[model samples]
Target: MDGTSSPGLARSLFLLLVVLLSSSVAFIEPCDLLYDQAVQAFYKGDYGGVVRSMEGALHSYAQVRRSKVGCRLRCEDQHPFDDDDAAAAAVAELRFFDVVLRRSACMNGCIEDKLGTQSMHRVSEDVVQDFHRRIPYNYLQLAYQKLKQPDKAAAAAHTYFQANPEHVEMGQNLEQYKDLQGVQEDHFVDREARPHQHSFSAGVRLYDQGDYEGAIVLFEEALEEYYKADVECRALCQGPQRFEGHNHLLYRYSLHELISVFRCTSLGFLENLVKRERCLSRKRWGCPSQTASEASGMDMFGRPFHLHGRLCREAGGFVVKAAWYLRRHKQELELLLIGSATMGVEFSEGQYWSSTGGREDSNRIPSGTDGWMEYVPISEKKNVSVMSPPQLREGGPLVYDSVRLVQNSIALNGTQRVLLDAVISEEECSDLKHLAHTVTMAGDGYRGKMSPHTPNERFEGATVLKTLQYGYEGRVPLRSARLFYDVSERARRIIESYFLLNSTLHFSYTHLVCRTAITGQQDHRNDLSHPIHADNCLLDPEANECWKEPPAYTYRDYSALLYLNGDFEGGEFIFTEMDAKTVTASVKPKCGRMVGFSSGGENPHGVKAVTGGQRCAVALWFTLNPLFRELERLQADEVIQALDSQAQSQWDHGLHINPKDEL
Candidate 1:
């Protein structure tokens, strides 16, 4: 009876807290409300209150994960994946981006639904960090200990210890639990852990028992949950930083307006290059760096960055906290790689209402974007009016005021150099789209071969060579082929100028590709049309690293996509972290909008599933090495020139050449 009443008490306390802090953080997660209840209960000697509140808090996580409440990303307004040989072979694959966005949107929507306000999606650092790090276990173990439930207390302690094995205090507590009565070895593990552990362990057992179907189901759960857990960690990493004295500093200032303004005390600078190397966030990506004295200004890529020298607060102090959750994901990967059932299960959020997330106050730029969220929106990036080449090319498109491609995000010396522009005219876009339909062949990207991804849909592509060949054979319009070649060359010149290369960028590969959703394959579709990947490296999913050699187009240094039309839906291009789990930035497809970026692991990207009409684009790649330039491009141009000459000569001769007589 007491156990049930505690949840009611928590809901009451949660309502009261909301009324009190409503004016503060407009958005608060659902689990956070229960978590707040647990914190209140702990302070008032209500140990049972803590257990009830935390349990409720943990279960409430299902709200963000479940699809019933519009938590999953909606592709309902569009068509579904095509039911092809590839789509029929397997179930739809959910990727890192789909899970991350779905979960983030769910959390946001859940908060908004509960509070009836729009403030929740921007979760405070305390809430994001606390929940994922299993901080509730910290309170739960102590609450259980005081409640005299040694078995439960030992389990909670073990869970927290696994997340933070370096903490001496937790280590000592575990040592004491060994001698505690009623605390068995089986009791020293998280029983209500994330769903994957049980499913995976059960699958291993079933596999050994030769229950193949049951084993398959369990393995699927493990795989899906592994995808979900990785998102939970990456989301937490995006929130604000609260170091040792953040709250105290808040108290030191009394003015309400000044309340939002506070700086981090210079807590020593970190010179650890080795540590940063292990981190997904690094400054050495192709972005140009500036020293402290340098003023904030725009670069050629059009990214605005301000250098703070030694004056800024270091994230290392607070950032390392995220590594704990990242390690959990790594362990899950290890669990899958080894396919072992013996792995341990574990996992577990609040705040003084820090003002770091607010715009016009103390804040940090979001990773993978240029000035977004206090953000620099893609719509506002029209600064570079010209090619701005480092050196003049004698025959380059001299003035491109109306045809420039703008960099979507700042480089910050990072791998991202994504540029967005609408250089093609509406007529040209229509022409290219028409040409794609004219020359498209069976199969999609693989060209009549089996899709490496799903069997549901098709990927169709025509290279410049194929387009030219088809046009000469009188199968497609000759003008459309010229249009395709012209657009690709324009993309190549834009890429060459934007990166400010000392030498010219040669065309390595240019393709016109289209992806379509099969009518009726739309149900249960949440996967990307093109899975997240780096252009120049082979992604080893188990290792979480992109190997930069061999079969990959190692010579290709840059990539660009020239969208012919935006008549479709749900096909946005996004730049992501190496894991392809967290989206750093996203660009919607539009007529004539070409997004270009480096073709390496420094800039991982993918296409969202096109749920509406067919999505078509001209994909282009450039290489610094001239030897590897598209030799076939030269042949295609030569053939087109020959056709032009033959037509002109026939017209000049005033005679048809069907008799096989030339001259």
Candidate 2:
């Protein structure tokens, strides 16, 4: 089909026609041979030979008839020109034929034949744009680096900030250079050192050689040795837990880098050993020890603290809920909160609780727990619906009785002073007092150990019913009520108010205020897909026995857990949902950072086991009242009626109508 075919076909046809017409002498096949030779010569760049052969064939053809070929081949039937003339004329004609046209056709044919071996050289712009939108932040950054366009790289970084504004440094840097052109050279420092920098190089080598389990053991031994050395160094410097006389930043940076390697590896035991190193360093650096007296006090970083009172949910009169934060405010809390989730804290009594505990009797609202009992319908949408659980009698860990106990215990020296022995700034004292009374009634479980009256009365630890984890029972009188006053009263009000205004539902609350050393893992039940739900929902399905008064039915509205103190570290919340969507929101152990969210099939939350420190908190759950129940029943009835009526109408029409006539 292409122009590369031989000219011999034309010559042969011409010669044959000549033989048939005049019975020409010799009936020479020389024309065919000459044409074949011309093609061979052409391959060898013999343009002259090709022209001669083509001209001879044309002249021979012109002497004969034009019957064999198509109409274009009907040339003059006479050999009017000599071979030389014919050759010149043929060559001129070929040259006049559009070379570009022939080349275009040939190019297409070549492309088709090579398609199987070729890669598509280009992608449409739309595809690239789509990738930019959905790709992960780290991947997008690498992509921009490859593109070598500083502006685009900066823009991608900005997009990352928009999505995760909690990354303070990254966000601030991005905002400073919104119109990115050239970046400052020192903006980023590659602080990631070679892994061997750590004194535990031998352990790292063992890990690299596929001895992960063994490496962990050796790493712990090295960590112990390092701690002993650091302690001696502290003694030489002055005392334990002080950073001095050296490049403090570099020292801190190196420590952080070393810790990061263990954290990244997810080798929990090795990480624990590294934390021991941190503890020694802290003592040497003069970091104040978080004593029982200090943690129980009301002052936070020497400031009079006031949480957003409006953004909480109230239960048993005590406000109980998590604090919701916009992106900007995450930083103020991050250092306090995120640091706690990182550093493992221990109980003053030498015991430490794991991060997460098993699901417990969620159906029953613990005594002193107070949360939303009424669901305020905000908006109505054709495709969306919201409802809360029915209201029931307030029982378990009674709030009113607990509040009275707290009020009687705290003796105020002056009207200005709220509670006796309560170390707080003037501003904080004022805020605490206001929050207490504003919360008409506040109640929560006493911070103590839990025990059954009889051996049989307690569900065997194996029983699923026994799985709910509560704080330890039996506490010192002086500290217990004081701790409760802040958490159950002051903190509770803020959480309750916040939820009523912003959150949709929060029905279950479980607060653990650590007064004694807590050590050992609490049972865990991830029976539901996103197994770790917040303390809002109770595990017991027998609703009647769990609540002070039965709900008349079963339902939970919402729940929250609030960290009241951030003296120690290493307690992060873990949540997993269907579709393998796992989210771990780290709660900084700060005075007032609250974690508030929905709990149900849609959102299940849990706290990651604490590694190094004692964790304390105030938890609250919300239940729907009469209004919540009435609305839900009404909606369900409507849907059922509508479906039934539609079915009946269809049947009636089918019996009476004729299909053809109806159409």
Candidate 3:
């Protein structure tokens, strides 16, 4: 009985142990076991294990595929699949990617059954057609096969021919298919893989295909070849001007066409002349045509002239020529001035004819806190200096070649007058005499030639009006733009000293000249040889103290007209003012002497028309500046602050500023 009882206990114990192990196994899951085992084998250099584990995962996946379908799958924390179904498809697709990625022919049919009727190539094609455009040739070849396009398959195989030229075997196989037309196309494509050539013929082909722009590029290449030859053959004695001229002309024309083609380019095109320098070489390297260079030195209407700078106490008393580089493309330069700059408040308040603070109907607008347009009434005290006549010698007309600013002055009113006198010197006098001769020669030569606008009678375009009218007044429009020069240092020094003496005085300044002959009959309707206008009218009446209040009055600033030589006949400084009705003031031409007064509508002044020979004079004007550069600096600061705040906000949001931001 005891032995039988012990046997029953043992059976029960054994059964209990089996039940416990079975429960543990059920909880662990066969898939989990396979996963762990496969991971371990994979790391131990058992690629077969990796395949087996991956297969086990798929097998487990298949068992409960319905439950896992359309569920998001994560790698780290990124969701590669947009949908659960996409996740499953990606898993299956990855296996095919892996096989083709390795370029393994060994695994050819391993996935055939699993892939079923959906070919691996079809899967690859779908991926590439959607988002994976950078597909491999091996995968693409397989895709062509599944598409049953033998010609495309052969074309794909031929892609590898460069590295593996022995692909003739594959090509022959593809030829067995009846798409002979496709095969022929592939052959033709292969032939075009030769080295390319750059020439006129090549460019002509491109041009014939409606590619004029491309043709231009080819022409440029041919031009470059010529340039290289010219460089190689450059002689030491010969100047490089010829070659440079050719190059500049070609480049200029090409750039012009390109600008028209795109219909857009930066201000760089206009500023090219400023940045480029003339270089000498047999090759037309940094070159320009003689005609173009000569043209640049002339005024807008193709008349020779020189740029000058001026300044005055009254408004419009000063007018400086725009920078030489900037003068050519005034429209573009104006855009820069208008778009970004904050103009003085007074400018917007009045029309072109009225001064900023003038009590005219056109300038009665009220001042605003912000905006480009605003009206600032001029204070009575501001016009105190305008009434006094500048003590300047009304000497013979003198001309100068160059001028530049140096140190400013800080003196009383009398001292300021003395400072202006200190600017003149013997050297300046001699320069005037030489300039007079040069002008005479140039005028003689120009007059001899058939004058383009000979009978300057009609009011044609602005060009015609300015050339004929202004020319008759003995005033030459500017030619090349003027820059800073040490020769005019004395004059600039005097102006600077005046400014220092009166910190309240702020204005722009420039120096100019009237050259050679004058054609009075052709300049204006009146028989008068010279016409003059006051310069003071540009100022606001309320702001200027020179003008009388209540009924309103006009003010005249300082203008210094110095005679360089006394070799001419009818050149005289004429001042026209409506003091006692209309008054005409005239001064004879004399070397070393200068006539000083106001200009424009404020004091209408002109040169008595040149009756004979040549006339040379150094003309300078000064104008007022209300707010000055200080205001400009303040505005710049405000713009910077706004930009900073915007930058901080972008930083907090973890985003970078756009490249296009106004950096």
Candidate 4:
């Protein structure tokens, strides 16, 4: 009987302990757990997760506050509260509301920073309320404006101004919104079908199809349409408002696209010239019929010419006597011959003579030349039907010779720096620009000053835009990524061979950056130039500077910049030797040129203000420590495979790869 009683006592004691533990665990409310999750998500840069978790917390808290039963079950406060239960509940509600508002503000900022205004609108609409509105309305106003909903933006701005009547900036913003609302309405009503827009779109399609000549014509048409639009706007609109009414933004964008198309077309022609020259050199086509000319000329209309030239191939130089027959239209034929004769022989080593109103020395040619001499036609438009004397041609190879890599030492004190010319091919340079432009179009233009909260004073008057990085998470565009990786690898090899840098050192990242000049506006004044600084530094926000003290580990040991285009003004890379108190060297941005140097105290450099056009470049940073080795190893194969897959997909889709809708 005593043993049975002991067993029952033990069972009851164990059951009591279990119930106590369960009650303690139940005291931890769902809202608290949700808030913790939201905080974690915010730190991880997962704005969407932050929004979801915060919304859940808000809903849970609201449910607990609305129902007494729910409050009793969930709100098991660990701290003791006196008889003033109503005040405690009020305090708790206010605290929870405060947390939600702060989280929502952060989420709104994230959306605005990354996804632009449309996303900001979606996120703002969810959080903004009449009772709890303060900062959210400001974001709502801006978001609506970007969405082209002027009326809604105006309404948001008005509400914000009414809430904070004494706020000077808010009042100013309200007035601006009101003014823009009228302009926006007028634009919507007055805007008509623009011919240029149609032409531009058609041209882009033709370009995608590789019909460059057709694309050029359409682009020209688009430019003419823009001019017509401007003229019409000037005639119709009042003084100072003529330019304001027309689509100037579209006009500027069209110009940019036209430039890109022209570049592509020019590159295509150059490539074809190289290919034809290569075939000729290889004797792919049987030795030129011993005919006067190696290759015959065709007119713009694709009509073959009765043109011939004597081939005088030489080791160092060659001289050819090119002759053409004039038909009924002698004037046109002579003019065409004069213009096109030099096109093939312009790159020759020695000067050649043309028979268009030029005296030929008797010593250079025999006394009685031949039937070719009798064919020389006079400048008059009459039809003589005579064949002209052969034009003397002396020039180097028809195609561009291989670029020789040349390195020059920069005269900077205390640093070993060099500029490498012909480091990359023209094709690679063009490819990089196209990739940068694509990425810029896809993302929010370009980012400046890393953080929005950071003061712009340090940036001077420059605006910099950066594309997705490579050799990390495969964020770079597929084609551009391959080009960048190739360039980076070449740079690494150059550093190893020329500078004698350790082969073990590896590049951490490669990215494209475009820098443009800025005009002073408001309190901010920025020059296109970047301030002198070393890449390896500890960011010290207290002093508003990059502290240049050496760290224990080697990071950013070297920097490499590959200039993509040289068609810009004023921006120059300058290296300052602090010890010598002199500018060591100033390098102009040249296409396919690469510059590399130590990114330490010995080499302090800055970009001079770009006064006119924008400058684009590829920046590569390397480090001795293998901190990013595993990341690069993991991403290398994935990136290559993804790029191959993308290329195959593009091929399958045929010409005219549609612009990505995600960006």
Ranking by TM-score: 1, 4, 3, 2
lDDT ranking from best candidate downward: 1, 4, 3, 2
Number of the predicted model whose lDDT against the real structure is largest:
1
Model 3 ranges with Cα > 4 A deviation: 1-427, 430-484, 487-489, 495-501, 504-511, 518-526, 538-557, 579-585, 599-602, 626-663
State how far residue 639 of model 4 sits from its true place (Å): 1.8
What C-alpha lDDT, on a 0 to 100 scale, does residue 235 get in candidate 3?
14
List lDDT for all candidates, in order.
0.57, 0.32, 0.34, 0.44
Cα TM-score of candidate 3: 0.25
Candidate 1 per-residue C-alpha lDDT over 340-393 given as tens digits, one digit per residue, 9 for 90 to 100: 223221111112122221122122211111110122222222222123622322
For model 3, residues 258-352, the per-residue Cα lDDT tens digits are: 32322222223212211211111101222332322242354563333321112111101100111222343354334434533443222211121
TM-scores vs. true structure, each candidate: 0.38, 0.21, 0.25, 0.33
What would the per-residue lDDT of candidate 2 be over residues 1-663, giving only the tens digit for each residue?
A: 111122233344544443354433223233334444554555566655555554454343333212112111222122122344446877746544534345434433432332221123122232233222322332334344445555544544544433333333344445444435575433321111122223344455565576655554455455434333322222222211211112322332333333332222212222333333223323323333432112223233222123222211011001000011111123433443444455431111111212111112222111111111111122221112235542322112222222211111013111100111112233443343332222212111221113111111111111000111010112222223233334433433433443343333322333333321224432342222113532322333332112111111234554455544555434555444432235523334455445544334344454444433444444544444422332222222233344357679999987996778877
lDDT of model 1 at position 84? 50
**For model 4, how does the per-residue alpha-carbon lDDT over 1-663 read when each residue is reduced to its tens digit?**
111122123323333432343332222235545655665666676655665665565554433322322112122221223344446888866666665455445434432332244221221111223213333345445555655767656555554443333333444555565456254432211011256545654555666676755655555455444434433332222111111122323332233233232222112212222222222323422334433232444354323333232221310011011111112123433443443353321111112222211113321221111111111122221222124622221111212234334444534333556676777788888877776655543112112233122222122111011222332234555456566656666776665455564346576555566655443421333543565666775333344434332221126777778788999767788876543235678889898777777665557677766665667887777776664442332244334555578679989888655679536
- On TM-score, the candidate that comes out on top is 1
Candidate 4 worst ten-residue window by lDDT: 315-324
Model 2 Cα displacement at 207 (Å)? 81
RMSD of each: 27.9, 39.6, 40.7, 37.5
Off by over 4 Å in 4: 1-407, 410-414, 441-481, 518-528, 538-554, 579-581, 629-637, 641-663
